[model samples]
Target chain A: MISNRLFIRLLAFAALVAVIAAIFWSQNPAFLSGGNIRALMRHMSVQGLAALGLTFVIVVRHFDLSFPGVASMGAMTLGWLIASGAPFPAAIAGALAVGLVFGLVNGIAVARFGLPDIVTTIATGGLAVGFSYFYSNGTSISQNFFMSGILDLNDKRIIGLDMPFAILMAAAGVAAVVLHASRVGAGMYATGQNRVSARFAGIATRRLIVLAFALCGTMACLAITLLVASSGAANVTAGGQLLMPAFAAVYLGAALFGRPSVGATLAGTLMMSTMLNGFTLLAIPYYYSDAIVSTVLIAAIAIFDPRLSGLLNFRKAAA
Target chain B: MSALTADIPQRRRGADFLMRYAFFILVAVVFVAFAILRPTFVTPGNIHGMLMSASIAGLMFLGLTWLIAAGEIDVSFMSVAALANMVTAALVQDGQGWALASLGGLGAGVAFGLVNASLVAGLRLPALVITIATGALAASIAAAIGLGTSIALNNTGFVGQVLGLRVGVLPLIAVIVAGLYAVSWFVQERLTFGHYIYAMEQNRAAVVEAGVPVNRMLFMLFVLSGVVSSLAGVLLAANLSSGQPYLGTSYFLDGLTAVLLGGMALKLGKPNVLGTLAATIFLIGLLNGAALLGWTDSQRQIVRGSLLLVGVGLVVFARSRRKT
Candidate 1:
């Protein structure tokens, strides 16, 4: 159920996006081209899917810093499997399986053993990346990847949307259902808001925490795996660059909605991807994108924080 | 609950005692096994080399010890270090004296830390996100100034000589690090502020009720982290004879591992200077031994990651067992 306030804000955001799009289009006629739109979707889905996954962990008040590691491992697994004569579907499953295992370990460690979320994820992620490094010894795994049908699948369109976007939509649909319209979702939200009270209410907060993390890690990997298929080579360092942008998207969503929600995350992902896309189309130096991400991230979080809200009320977050 | 804990099975008590000493046992076993398997590993030259490599990360870990003890985290300091590193290198390249360059770098790090403290401690924002934001800013600034490349120091010979000052076969940096740890130990074990920081970590409400200044304590911890990290950057520059805009990040995993591994040792769930010091040695030894055994970089990293989890798991299990 969308609140009236959120609905109005969404409309206003759409207007802002439209204005930005017009400005970009005025600068470059190819800004709204079909191929460019597809390319943008492909790029956005990577951060989009990862940010969607991150929403769960953040809502539960936990962080999984291991996404980059796990995601790289997933991509590496796909590349490694394909290079070793494995069938494409089997290779995809292999990558997802690796993601699931890592996610499960992360959740179990945090929920069962009571480890800190940050360091545990960092350790596990590092372990995953270390393992990923072994397949090619720090080189990109490119053998047989081009000959595989992955590129076809990666670019294939389903209902006018690319494969990556299609996957993103399916995942987002599932997230929207599970996070908003389900009993377990409510329990998860309650757990995030107050763990002790959720436990007293018989919510099985630990199990929900585990579930949130498992889903988070798996989706993070899925996003990166699809992205690697698009890029055609899997390097151990490929996922490192995704952290700031994806994090910005998730936090931006949470700030927009007063808390993390599925739709807001998707919207935030769209905004971030488009902004980066615009930057690419413009004559801006590529290095400035990192600065832009940092600014947006700080601004997004700063606005919602009570200490800065008074300063922000006349500006963005008054809505 | 107290009465129930008064009696325990002898077998369980033995297990508990072993659990408490497991870190030392592991360290000893690894060291002795390495020495026996490779006699050359115990040579003074190799030990000195290890000590030399350990000091930079050791310095950062010491600062992190304070932050972690206060229940705060800084993902930004390394990036801040990178900023400091590049600033020093850039200034040195501009024909600045060593003192001026060092000050320029340390100033950048200090400013970054104070900003982090204000947002995290004053505004009560989440530390991770704020630090990450600041970290990104620092890295960006470093890259912008350094043109996204590394800068070599101007007076390499002189810088090396200064940082490499030795007294009676002991590198002055190592001595300084040890002295710094002694100061940390003094503050942690003997000072009221140290006790207050720990108490704040354990229970913020109780500390507030007692009218302790929480924000000031947080500022001190973060500033300490930033200052030490900045110094680590300078030492790192001397070690490498060059500084990259993103170089300090290479030490992040090493720093965190040492700090967390330390938490599982002497203090057993509490991050402390002695634990960081010992764990730093243990970590450097593990890496050194792996290299001596012809292990690949991947293999060393894999082992290090696994040990990190195991160490944290032991800390968790120890806490649970003690509570029960």
Candidate 2:
């Protein structure tokens, strides 16, 4: 069974890589082109920024459904600040502050009220979207000269890859070190594994949960910046479509990286994005594209926990 | 002795009746407030429209209440409903009779529900996760086979008319919904399965110790939910005269809101079917009234989502209080 699990993940990875290679070969005939790889990496970086925060939330067994709302709020607020003649650094800081407040509200709701994660987040998500819509007045934010400097992060490459790609890699590294190499990360895992036990162990489970939300909100804030720089527009619906892909990445990370690891989440984001990019390049039908993602998600669930596949003879609750 | 016994039963009956009906009174108060705000809101025709609007979805909630009360979720119902609609539509298009279409839709619903139950019961997977995955899978499969477009029923014939007709100014769907509530109430309050479902919900380990096939009971609950949901979908297809993949999304919030709002406490073991039916009407009334008051679509979504949040909060609070 262990071998079977490994083989399936390996197949998933191999398939992802093969699809990318095929797309590259068909489009440019220069499969190893530096510019193309850099471009892909640049896109991956923006997606990674948001996916990283989502990883923190999901690993702790709570989903941040309000992520898109937070992201849109941050992005539009940043654009508004920049448009009002703020410096780049100040605009970014202001955006992060907005995210922080939203995160705090979510933390208070979940920790103090003991609300169900799904209920609280779904409500907060709509609230955030509503706030964003009201704030933006149902229009996309305009680009500014200051925003142009932020966009340059995608254009500059170190050696053959873009700086944004490197930044994404560095962010993943930090997440890994914090989660696996630190006490706080252990506390998060403890809290998620069993709240009652974690509280008994003096883990300050509530605070750690709050910290997880803050991290998620911060990451989403940063991702909004990157998204704005890349797409040059901050519409209300900009962050909505990313939810599915973000969720897909987290689940894929669990399947690929040995359960909810930050590194796994990062890898999953890249893999999912690459799949979409390659499929589009290959001229696959839209419905088929959806089919592929759904199939992979289910396959991952079945493979990651074989007993959960319902193939065993006893047919009893084992997991 | 006969007089004393009669008094005792009368007192208990009064309390039970109040416990069952207090929530409906609360709804009536809200309805009065809305009617006062908008004079036309309480009109007979508008009230009938509201009942028709909620009937199909309210019926689905009747089934879902049992599954949720069993401490398991079946989010796959909407997707299964979509599949059932598409299959029935396809059958009808292929020159099959209406009865066959309805049967096909219901049978497929049960089969899919069985699949969901098997996943949750046999595999020990989390019900929420399993249902979500399978739901998406089912939806994708349906879309793939749906001829790459939405299907509209052009010919009514006898089957369509019977399913679609109104009975004494009330939609047939509304009658079916009332019938479903009665059946669900009987099964939950009077049947043996109801006892087992409650036992499992309260303490599954104890139920297993008693050598009851807990998995089978839970599985059957999901199957029941699926079959009922498909029936709802067929009724919907007749009413709307079309089938589309995206049509089921709204029902997710609708059914969830009704079940939660109708005093269906999590700790109560099984949900109140009659209460759920009333709550369904409440929601329908609120939406229709909001529309008449000139609220925009986005405002409607915001209202619905917020109302659901409040309902969930109430349930959580009630459950905690009962514990105290």
On DockQ, the leading prediction is 1
For model 1, how does the per-residue alpha-carbon lDDT over A1-319 read when each residue is reduced to its tens digit?
5678678777876886798788888999888998788878888888998898888988888999998888888888989999998988898888888888898899999998899998899899889989988888889987898777888768788987788889999999999999999988999899999999999999998998998888888888788888888889888887787787778888777776677899888878887888789889886655576677687778778766654666766567656
Q: For residues B244-282, could you state the per-residue lDDT of candidate 1 as single tens digits? A: 888866777888888877877766777778888888888
DockQ of each: 0.66, 0.37
CA lDDT, every model vs. true structure:
0.83, 0.72
Error of 2 at A229 (Å): 3.8
Candidate 2, residue B42: Cα displacement in angstroms equals: 3.3
Q: What is the model-wide C-alpha lDDT for candidate 2?
A: 0.72
lDDT of 2 by residue, B1-324 (tens): 567536555665465455445556767887888888898997877877687778877866766888766767777788887877777776677787778887887887888888787777766666765676677766766676574576777764565686557889787868877886898778876897777776777799999999999988887788888888888777666666766656666676667667655744322224567667777887787788788888754576577567556656655554564454
Chain B TM for prediction 2 = 0.84
Give interface RMSD, every candidate, in order: 1.2, 2.5
